[model samples]
Target chain A: AQSVAQPEDQVNVAEGNPLTVKCTYSVSGNPYLFWYVQYPNRGLQFLLKYITGDNLVKGSYGFEAEFNKSQTSFHLKKPSALVSDSALYFCAVRDLTSGNTPLVFGKGTRLSVIA
Target chain B: EAGVTQFPSHSVIEKGQTVTLRCDPISGHDNLYWYRRVMGKEIKFLLHFVKESKQDESGMPNNRFLAERTGGTYSTLKVQPAELEDSGVYFCASSNEWRTGELFFGEGSRLTVL
Candidate 1:
């Protein structure tokens, strides 16, 4: 079964400092990885996805993720964080081997960007 | 374009009561999906609908849960005699033909069973 693991329960960082949220996955075939953010009283919003090609994929709101195939990791990163960036981040993976399989999500890491 | 919308933002019901959640997918979206996030748990898939037909329902917890999409439009998920364990936030998502995997989610319906 394909699964995504977000090791950190929560990450705290100062505003304007760099931030990283770790994510690792296990899948039988090539993985379709994604990052989503959920704000208070809102639905999950798509941030980025890694389907193929580029190892580094850039996403909305100055976010980027590096897809390390050998490491089985897709870590979300931002050069400079803002207080508004604080939210719950989730890593998800889709099993490419299975036709149109539902995405499996991680437990989610709460990000706190202090001003 | 309007994103996916779910009705009754929050519902509090007693155990063994029936509850029905509604989701309206984006215009012209052929694929709709149902998911839920229980307290202290990761979001889990419940089912997928391709038009009015159910594509995959393997993730549904049990027979007490029933989902339907009539005429390939709006979808509804009904829980008969809900259990306390069923308290969670139910989310609905949709994607069009061009972007099959890129799902747009609704604000979700929060259900509380006591």
Candidate 2:
């Protein structure tokens, strides 16, 4: 089974400060990791994904994530936070070898950027 | 391009009643997926469809949950005798390329069973 764990239920950060939303995974085989964000009253929006490449992958809205194969972690990061960046973030993973198996998502982390 | 769209943005009903949710996938998209997010929980896969065929239905919870994509352009999920635990947000997604797995999602249909 492929699973993703996002330890923090909530993360608070000040505007202009760097922010990080942690995520870890467990999979029987290599995993495809992804990050998605949900704004108020909006659906889940794709942020970034890590398949197989340079550990660092950049995504939309100036967000990026580093894939650590050793620790089985793919943590989302941003250089600076903005008040509008506050939303619910979800980390998901799927076993690459599992064919069309669906993505397994974390419980999600709510981020609040205080201006 | 028009993204995936779901009908009945919100629905409130009594337990034991039936509810049907619909989704229209993007034009030219061959793959459509259904997912549900229970209150304060992770979004979970309910089923997947490739064209009009049921690609995978393993995630479907029970027999009461019925999904169909007759024309393959639009899909509908009908829950018979919906239970209180069935109340959740149902999200529909579509993708031409399921391999990369970057799915375009709909705003979701919020179901509330009292």
Per-candidate TM-scores read: 0.98, 0.98
Measured by TM-score, how close is model 1 to the native structure?
0.98
Restricted to chain B, the TM-score per model reads 0.96, 0.98
Candidate 1 Cα misplacement greater than 4 A, ranges: B98-100
lDDT of 1 at B12: 99
lDDT of 1 by residue, A1-115 (tens): 8999999999999999999999999999889899999999999999999999989999999999999998999999999999999999999999887777888899899999999
**Model 1 docking category:** medium
Tens digits of per-residue lDDT, candidate 1, B46-106, equal 9999999999999999999999999999999999989999999999999884233688899
What does each candidate score in C-alpha RMSD? 1.1, 0.7
What Cα-based lDDT does every candidate model obtain?
Answer: 0.94, 0.94
* Per-residue lDDT of model 2, residues A1-115, tens digit only: 8898999999999999999999999999889999999999998999999999899999999999999999999999999999999999999998989787888889899999999
- Candidate 1 chain B minimal-lDDT segment of 10 residues: B95-104
Tell me how far candidate 2 lies from the true structure as C-alpha RMSD in angstroms: 0.7
